[model samples]
Target: MQNPTAATLYSQKQIPIGLKNTIDKTLSEYLKDEKLASYNIDNLKQIIEDSKINFNIKTIKWDEDGSEKSTSAEVASILGMILTFIIYMFIIMYGGMVMQGVMEEKTNRIIEVMISSVKPFDLMMGKIIGIGFVGLTQVFLWGILTTVLVSGSLFFFGGNTSPEDMVAAQMAAQGVNNVAAGSSDISIQVQEIINSINFGMIGTSFVLYFIGGYLLYAALFAAIGSALEQQEDAQQFMTPIMLLMAFSLYAGIYSMNNPDGPLAFWCSMIPFTSPIVMMVRLPFDIPVWELALSFALLFATALLIIWFSAKIYRVGILMYGKKPSIKEMIKWVKYK
Candidate 1:
């Protein structure tokens, strides 16, 4: 029965419907046989009874046009959260690669030759841009490949036909009306959720935030890489940056239940965490002003950071042996 054949399925005038499910039986037996510190039959019975009790409940929501709402925002929130995590990882992973690439070139004395002809700012930017394209290409390939694979699999396995529907179909073909209610409601709800998404807005915002976030962090990583004499010294500078990104990630997750909360609002506006946090709020349709301001701050901060980091890159790219301190980097920014 675990892997029923076509003949077995066709032979059935009646299809079984979960009365003697072996998996549930096995799980129940395991729970009953298990020993636990918190095991109490009386308490367990009370919990089971409580779970069976149902209260009369009704939910009413209206759309912008005053029509009653049936779509679930929970799905949108989950999708937004997933996108936020991807942005977080994309920035950190590619930004770290930028730093490592700079460290490698400088360590091998290749920077000296490259710098003889090219300005430090141009060289630094070229490296960042090159690595950024590579990251973009990788993501594009993954998106294409995943969509193809999923579509192919769905086609191969009978697209959109649930097992219950298949069984019911077979029975119906044999002149039997034993088919119970199919999960067509679930499918309709899924379709509604898909239709509810504003892809134009979300897609454009995702790309904008993605680019701005990467540029801001990659510039910081480039400066840190240029300033460090040894790769082992990265921790002293990277600790705070890592903590900031981590906090942004956590803020995004926490915002799922309350996207309009004060924490989410501030994090979305602050350039340091906006890229990650704003993603979680995008699906919720946050105000236009909030979105515009967050985007503005992100790009503005990225440009300013690039200008200052370029100054450090100029000085540190040439100096060798001595490790530059925070004070030295600050002074490097002021160098003519």
Candidate 2:
């Protein structure tokens, strides 16, 4: 009776639900015979009991050696997704803040006073980097806190646990011996996933791509904010940016089933989508050359975009009340 939400359409759990629906509908249509309909509840119960139509499905992911993998691909995908979501939120939230701050200064005519002394490019970079530090500091603190908590918990569990308790825990992890046992299994699985992750690689790449991705998007956002007289005036420009963000996210998700597939390979190469899509591939242990190439491309693209965005900011920030078309913004980028 569980009705999956729209987001659940992406989940693999729907396979069993689809199977059940097929069987139920087929049974219902064929059970319309008057003789069958006349069967008593007891008769139906006896028929079902005697039918012996039972299914017990167990899934195990095998490694190259034919041994069961310690962690499921689905669980690994979830970890990759969580990393991507954090980066996405950081970019959007901090990048939007940069845009809003620029808009506030322009609308109040404060930038006019400030810009006479500060270069437009300097002002834009200052705002972008200043806000970026705040996000970086917050995430750094969260990392410290999480590491301490996990380490403390591990110390207690590993050092003080009794032999009997550890045995019991292993049993619970292997089977649903009791409610407490089942919970133990979940915890063990989580620990296994954590142990298997390449935090050094993921953490380093995350900081690099997070900063690079934010810089790239924030530049355009700042340019749009400077060009518009009112927030409503920016919607036309915002639509394309929003669509691009959504497509990047969806591309990353679809590539999870095949991290090395053509889609994943290409998406991770593109600077616009690579930040999100590359995170999805990190857990799968992609090659060193590929990772290096992706990293170089992202920062290179970011730097190039920031240069053009600063040009647009220089021209648009001074203009008042005129709604700049995308074509006009392009012309600003071409200025000497």
Candidate 3:
């Protein structure tokens, strides 16, 4: 009898049936002797039938609305995660740009000249808003360009193949049809998954969170820049801010795995971490009330942070030659 190889097992149709037939033929021939021939054929048939089987498993998930296929959920989860990471990186990158620009102006003594004409609050708000708009413009352009390129590619190359067909082809290439009905079910639901995503909600929430999160952190970053006479002096103040951002990142990651967990719920509520965490959770079925509350808290907190940062910025920008301690910063905040 020929032994089945990996290629034959995965690539061949009716694999178990073919193997059983071959085994039966081989066994009958080998047992042709009278002593073996006396054995019960019924028993042998039962054994062969019992052994002739293949496994194909499928998982069906149910949400509050109705039954959900795993493939659709997986696709949504992946897209949400990618967007979350992109937003997180963008906030950090652009926030740092604001800090660096402020430091450069201060270093060159250009701020003194600028300040001669402008109030510190106005100057600080101008820099923050200007840099933030630049970041937002870049993000908007990137979104538009990405959409155009992706749509063009799909139109040019995607051809008549439906999403299901595409998924089936990919699975067939890998030779693993573990899903039920040989990927047919998953393929059928691909369009449904695509349609289920709330692109409008995501886009709106992303823009709001991106701006809110960036403004919240950028104010503090600008305050840090104003306090330090040299670049090195910024490090001591920046460490705590960096750690808070890092915590938000980790919280976002955790939310990806457990979107409805208590940790994710609280993270999405906190102003410091909500920007990243809430965005991560938005793709899922979070309640309207929770989202509304999170937004309100974040908006209020951003205003409070900006007000506090302005106080620090006014005093810190003028002080020179010596690095101020946390105690001294409090005194600056208290100064009328």
Candidate 4:
């Protein structure tokens, strides 16, 4: 009954003789009398509850945690759209960096001197990383600002929603009749959609996918910039990457229509497109094994692309007479 006795009893190598005897007596007494069994179970529950009691009990919201299950499809759909918008904005932002970097080097004729001082790969990497950090810093600042705005809006609008509103919403969806005559169908659908979205998966997939996708394109853009000695020369190379990015983005949008379809599965599995495709599918569900495999593929593809791009970058930085054709670029990829 006391803490010290309970601790000692628990710490024993084997159940102590006295405690075993007490348990045997209790079980025997309970078994012999039907009324005593109910009383015994109640007493045991009380004892366990008393022993385990803590401040956590006061804060526990068992009703919510243990409450009804909900789908996250609607939320996933919303997040996918938001992510698509952000990705395009990112392309415009960082892709502009590639063009600007090319223009800067061309104007200063610094590309000539830089190639002599450092390996083209190093210069390209350093420039890309430095610029990428700037972009990331801007993004982080924007996120913080947005969060503050949202919180402010919620506060100003009194986001303190009533529990009855939640209950009524849930009940109406389940067809609990005559609960609320005035509840809007739009509100109910919105709540259902909001409830369907899996926030955890959406957030996780978004972070990983966006970062991977960005790194992949950023490296490609940097390599492209390194290859061009003039802004005009860069345009020829720019179209293809732009097309790839646009195609991948559009493919992601198409995949959203059928999150669980075969095309979506393959699209999300491909590292180049997965960032957008997987984010779109997060609302439906991504299997753990599939996600892992997709990640592995993405990492491997990134490494390979960076390696080949570095090779291209090595020769490309020094190239100045004229723009390299596709054939010449292929030679760089295979060069020792």
Question: Cα lDDT of all candidates, in order?
Answer: 0.80, 0.81, 0.78, 0.67
| Candidates 2 and 3, the one with greater TM-score | 2
Q: Give a tens-digit lDDT track for model 4, residues 179-281.
A: 3433443344344445445555665565566566666777787677766766667677778877776777787788777878888899878887776667666
Indicate which candidate wins on lDDT: 2
How far is 93's C-alpha from truth in model 2 (Å)?
1.5
Q: Report the lDDT tens digits of candidate 3 across residue range 164-226.
A: 676667667655555544445444554345445666787788889898899899999888888
Model 1 TM-score, 2 decimals: 0.74
Q: What tens-digit string does per-residue lDDT give for candidate 2 at 162-278? A: 435765777856654566666555555555555556777887888888888999999989999889878888889989988888888888888898999999999998998998888
Q: Using lDDT as the measure, name the better of candidate 1 and candidate 4.
A: 1
Badly placed stretches (over 4 Å) of model 1 are: 1-51, 54-63, 67-69, 145-181
Candidate 2 Cα outliers beyond 4 Å, as residue runs: 1-69, 156-192
What's the residue-level lDDT of 210 in candidate 2?
Answer: 88
- The RMSD (Cα, Å) of candidate 1 is 12.3
> How far is 256's C-alpha from truth in model 3 (Å)?
1.1
Clashes of each: 0, 0, 1, 4
User: Order the candidates by TM-score, highest first — what do you get?
Assistant: 1, 2, 3, 4
Error of 4 at 47 (Å): 68
Q: Provide TM-scores for the models.
A: 0.74, 0.74, 0.72, 0.65
